[model samples]
Target: MDSAASEKSIIALDGWLKSPAGIYVREWEQACLDELTANIFGYNAVQVGMPQIDALAANRMPNKWQAATRMSNLDELALAAGNKQIAVALDFAELPFASQSLDLVVMPHVLEFAAEPHQVLREVERVLIPEGQVIICGFNPASLWGVRQGVRRITRSPYLPVAGEFISMPRMKDWLKLLNLGVTRSHFGCYAPPCRSTHWLNRFAFMENAGKRWWPYLGAVYMVHAVKRVKGMTLIGPAWNKKSASASQGVPATNRK
Candidate 1:
């Protein structure tokens, strides 16, 4: 609910929407949207970023109502999706909504730019029901795009105006665990390369397909589907046990007891 953070997020989102890479990013985002729409476990859903695009992609989903927020694009997209409920605000990393109020939360590249990713993810966990699903799409820091960024840095030139951390899937998985969420499935793709000149490479689909199946670690982006675990679930970890001595004679006890 920080107004300043909200403004920054809005500005960043606007810039991204106007970028060439944003188009490809949106295509990847649509993949997540399609999955979410197909699995509406609740009557209400909320999209955290790029509400307009999400609404457009999720137009056919049946829900009592869908709400989207982030910057000012909510209204137009909501109208297009035939949804009347809309919330205009920012700092989605720290949502103002009540606990377990939403059943589904879709984040498209929201984590890559987040200054405090863990905080944002925890907030997402807070707002989702126990069974709610959080679908996230983020850039892979260890992929071809990552290599391109490294080259840019080496040459003292960068594609993105603002530099942020490129999070890996393993790191994100750990973050989810800290928030008591379990990752059920993950998909990685965008192997066509990060250069604008290589846009035609996407038409083949073979690169992305084979890359995801055979070389997930090298995919440019990754989509993860995580479900919030019910509170108080017992988590088992490694256990270390040592033999105890008998109280009477102080004799060493066996491991059997």
Candidate 2:
């Protein structure tokens, strides 16, 4: 991302976090949390970035959930609440956790705000055990939110930074491929139009019933559930690797390294 875009993203994120949009985002994230808890049944489930939801889950389902944050102050609180899985690093793209240590990883709109989304996904892939799952919630770049953002840009509002990139689901799937993860299921929700009371929009049974069935892809937010793939397991990898390596043999070994 460019500097202007990055700045826009930061501004937008800060604003959302402090505005009514935060509540809506939180509701969407909480719904994701429920789905994650139901689908990924295990002794160790890791929720990254969202501490409040983790705390709630810990209280509700003590044995199955743990919360991790980049904030150091939350470490004590997490531990106090029986969550000793706090990560104190400021850069989430490079987490301080060990590889293959977690069964499930929940990313609550963290990718949109991340400086290096690919790196964050890599870190997620690293910490997740084989066959482990990752559930990500993100604002769709092609939905109601995306149109709002476009309007903000046209109007030259200071609400959003130019550096902000609203990622689409297909693009995210491509990123997941780079990390050797495969999407198992995906669902889009929150199609009550982009009003301030977006949180209450999802609560309406009528909207939920119609939006999910008829205009599923037109929602402001979407959720994806993907499973990590075993490395070197692709069908055409050996041939592709040989071709790639041979193509690079022209360069000096040191330079290639």
Candidate 3:
């Protein structure tokens, strides 16, 4: 049931992405993802979901792939018809890639709408090699947009997709920590009020500057870059063992006295 609901949610969100509001949201997230993945060094990079925007456009990884549950042709994606990288159909909860093979994975607005967001993340984590990176883009629920969404829900209308369970930044960070993925950096954008009219949106555009200067972290959306860290890697030195033995000898000798 969750999977079916998730699929329906994604289909609805995909339709929403074609709207003016969705375009507004995409502009901010696209620029953020481009910069975050541009200079990142990696061999195998994959972008899961949201083929409308090429998440790895700026990334220079030798091998790149886009995996999604639904069909997305080359015409819709930046991956040209003849390009080596092609979009593949796969479930987010169960990725087809081998374990510890991917160097980088981009999830643009995938988690917020996923029924099994944690399981989706676990699949990404499984494919990423130790120290590998994953870039996540999502709608922030602590901003003006979030407030607006709440108001919409009361009126039986939602500005954003109603099916999505928007995760907060701190909560997202916690989920990553649980999976051994440490958030190295994050960015926020889309400060202007969500409006249908281009004029109204443009008039409030100045809020972008003010919002960044005054409340940078409270943007309408955010992109998080986290790296998988393997702990317990520090090797104990023989000298430390010898020091411990000496310290134990002192305690025994003193006890005898």
Candidate 4:
């Protein structure tokens, strides 16, 4: 899509996020993000796109940024000012940060709308330090919301943003694995059906508990926390080989006895 079209779609997404259904998604994602990022120790962190949601609010990182693809994204700039966070405008596929410079990166609903999602992931991997974590929030394509969106597409009025191409958990994991980012933790929530009205949404609130217990993976949204893994990296442990050999030499051989 052209830049103008992309910008329009993003603006639409922002508006959608303020709606009742979008608010429901935001609340679940925010709680999950807070829990996921609270214990992460990091010097630098960046939240890419969807600036309305402060994905790094719980993170105690000394240096943090909210980045967007264009400076025209006013919501992020305003949010950054309020939160006292540095705001950056840069291409997701070519981040300005040096290789292995960032400790954490949070992406909420970015990949689905990105032009080159794979390249964006590659950039994320390149910028992250070894063992650094990346938290992603995405819509699941295997849920009731997904079904609704698919059906709505036939009518040319998608329930979600038209630009968004929801990625399945399995596919997302494969993308991360290719970049050596191992998924350390994951969560699924927002089991409610795709109801645009607030009343209907509240009525289905009971489905949250039942869905988590019975059909966990079929939630409307998912949060994934993955850590970067270095090739051939191993932890140094105490040497027990020499002590074991010495102890064995002092023992009598069973065959000789």
Best candidate per TM-score, number? 4
Model 3: lowest-lDDT 10 consecutive positions: 75-84
Model 2, poorest ten-residue lDDT window? 55-64
Writing each residue's lDDT as its tens digit, candidate 4 over 1-257 gives 64456667777788899999999999999888988889899799988888677888898988988776654546646755356365555567777788999999999998887767898899999999999999999999999999988888477768888777789999999999999999988899999999989999999999999999999999999998899999998889877798778888887788434
Full-model lDDT for every candidate: 0.68, 0.66, 0.84, 0.85
Q: Give the Å shift of residue 50 in candidate 1.
A: 2.2
Output the lDDT of residue 72, model 1. 52
Candidate 3, residues 1-257, lDDT tens digits: the string is 28788888888888998887788888778787888888989799988888778788888888988785644444655443223366455568888899999999999889988878999999999999988999999889999889889888477778888888999999999999999999999988889887876678778889888998999999999998999998876646656677778878777665865
Each prediction's RMSD over C-alphas, in Å, is 9.1, 12.4, 6.1, 3.5
Residue 77 displacement in candidate 2 (angstroms): 6.8
lDDT of 2 by residue, 90-171 (tens): 5666666679877777776668766778888989999888888888877787776678777885776533234556689999
Candidate 3, residue 84: lDDT: 32
The positional error of residue 1 in candidate 4, measured at the CA in angstroms, is 3.9
The TM-score of candidate 3 is: 0.85
How many steric overlaps are in each model, in order? 0, 6, 0, 0
**What are the runs in model 3 whose C-alpha is more than 4 Å off?**
70-84, 87-90, 234-257
Candidate ordering by TM-score (highest first): 4, 3, 1, 2
